[model samples]
Target: MTAPADVPPEFLDRLRPICRELPESYEEPAWVGVRWRIRKRTFAHVLTVDPDHQMAYARAVATDEPTCVLTFRSPVDELHALVAGGHPFYKPGWGADVLGMVLGDGVDWAEIGELLTESYCLLAPKKLAAQVAGPAGLCC
Candidate 1:
């Protein structure tokens, strides 16, 4: 199967199962790339940001080349710790709890799964959220 034009197939392949395992979550095309949603809220979104066209992401990461980015929600308290080191992670401007991760080279698939699971818990209803285990050590 062909990958979507905006993001690489390998990235999607890695992400799909993690999101799929969440209760009641579904995948759909977003305006720029792809997103996984629980009910009506988006838990995770992956897209390619062209430095020339997507200035916000480009400026945040300070990259001259195109970047594949994954944006997901995190507990507000954990946001700082996640983005502190900087490069692969950054707090996005739009949401208080939203964080963006640069997806390429040496990326950690296990961490991504944990983050996405936590993200799903954040947006999902209590009943639905409890259906799946939260990330290790994190109480969602």
Candidate 2:
């Protein structure tokens, strides 16, 4: 299947390697769009239903919501723009990828390891989040 124009292949490949696999036996609703819920609430964004685009994004909240998604935050937009040559647009689950690139910066792979660890702190079930982390970018 063809991927949406807004998505990059490397980007999708990078993300699918990190997130939970889409359930093959499950079905999706019409026009509701593909969505991935981060931390179950803080973020929710649409994805392309086409099999090729392994991406996701957050549901945009009211502008005044302080707890709005970080992906929507200016820094993320600006950083992504400079880094990926795009605007605030995201392809879901890509945050984990960025967190790795952002934290690594050539000198520290371990820092990326830490950010991935903390990501689950704000993302996983309390019980799982409490367990000591095993590895970052390791099949989630």
Candidate 3:
């Protein structure tokens, strides 16, 4: 996918709080990546090795990356809106070609928590199974 052009106003409105609260767990080394961290560890990233400006958010760690890269189904109208410039990224787990599902700019903070919770659940160590916020009450 190419860089995105328009930032979704509604999505940003809801994403700020989660970004504020998710980073409270760290006081030592600090997390890695561009933005968004959980307990001082990276949970989301604006920078990427991917050339499309494709951002990544945690959806369960895959390989060595802290978060899975965002991907979406191709040929969708929302993605088509980003022909010029915008932050290009997909919802992790969905492939790079899928276009209908765009992540980063249009999601709310509660949704961000929900998304992170899901990712944490996916990548979370088996020992933290009960502690990691998965699907139940992540928004609260």
The number of the candidate with the highest lDDT is 1
lDDT (Cα, tens digit) per residue for candidate 3, span 1-96:
322422334443454454444324221221322244444344433322232333333332222332223222233453346433333333244444
Whose lDDT is higher: candidate 1's or candidate 2's?
Answer: 1
TM-score of each: 0.91, 0.32, 0.34
Give the C-alpha lDDT of model 3: 0.36
lDDT of predicted model 1: 0.87
Residue 69 lDDT in candidate 3: 32
- Clash list (residue pairs), candidate 1: none
| Candidate 2 lDDT | 0.32
Note the Cα lDDT for every prediction shown: 0.87, 0.32, 0.36
Q: 56-138, model 2: which lDDT tens digit per residue?
A: 32222212211111221123443355446422223234443332121111323243234334443455556655453455543
Error of 1 at 109 (Å): 0.5
Each candidate structure's count of clashing pairs: 0, 7, 19
Error of 3 at 66 (Å): 23
Off by over 4 Å in 2: 1-5, 21-35, 42-117, 131-140
lDDT (10s digit) by residue, model 1, range 35-69: 99999999999988887777887787677788889
Better of 1 and 3 by TM-score: 1
- Per-residue lDDT of 25 in model 2: 16
